[model samples]
Target: MKFDVLRAHQGDKWYGVGDTRDAREVEVQHLVDRGVLRKAAPDVLNKAAPPVQNKAVSAPKNKASK
Candidate 1:
């Protein structure tokens, strides 16, 4: 899920708006609803990138058994 980074607090644990994850969207929206965090525009996300997809890793071969 793409949780586009909108606004960050303290440089980490960044909370933003417009998330692909529904749960996270609700969480952030809840915070906004409660007035703890303000709504963030998606302009920052437009300037940033999406997370990279996972790839398969091969295991190393051992030659000792030969």
Candidate 2:
């Protein structure tokens, strides 16, 4: 079952499982040992990536503005 979850999320940042953190970590490690999944880079797992910060415009500022 654990292996199935890992396989389903082969290259995802965090497999969407509700298991405890320790259990998830162990499962991930097992998958890695079995050459089933690879660890994602730190940047890839950045859960706190800043929300899209587009500049706020009060009104249309383009040639097509009405």
Candidate 3:
């Protein structure tokens, strides 16, 4: 199951608040019950990263030409 961590926690790995993680249903339930993790919304898991912009570069002039 996918969960959004509500508080800092450490199991096999460390999980911080606002971190999203995939965990076994049983483990997720245990954390949810403890108020440390909650099921993540589908949209949250599917959020896309912002696109990178490509910039144009000019060729450097030869110093010997000066």
Residue-level lDDT for 40 in candidate 2: 47
Worst 10 residues of 2 by lDDT: 1-10
lDDT of residue 16 for candidate 2: 45
Q: Per-residue lDDT of 1-66 in model 1, one digit per residue for the tens?
A: 134443343223445444322235555665456544554446575566777877877565867644
TM-score of 3: 0.61
Lowest-lDDT window of 10 residues in candidate 3? 57-66
- State which candidate has the highest TM-score: 3
Question: In lDDT terms, how accurate is model 3?
Answer: 0.84
Q: Provide the TM-score for each candidate, comma-separated.
A: 0.26, 0.29, 0.61
Each candidate structure's count of clashing pairs = 0, 0, 0
> In model 2, what are the clashing residue pairs, if there are any?
none
Give the lDDT ranking, best first. 3, 2, 1
Off by over 4 Å in 1: 1-23, 44-66
- lDDT by residue for model 3 over 1-66, one digit each (tens)? 788889998977998899988989786787799889988898865789879877876566986755
| Order by TM-score, highest first | 3, 2, 1
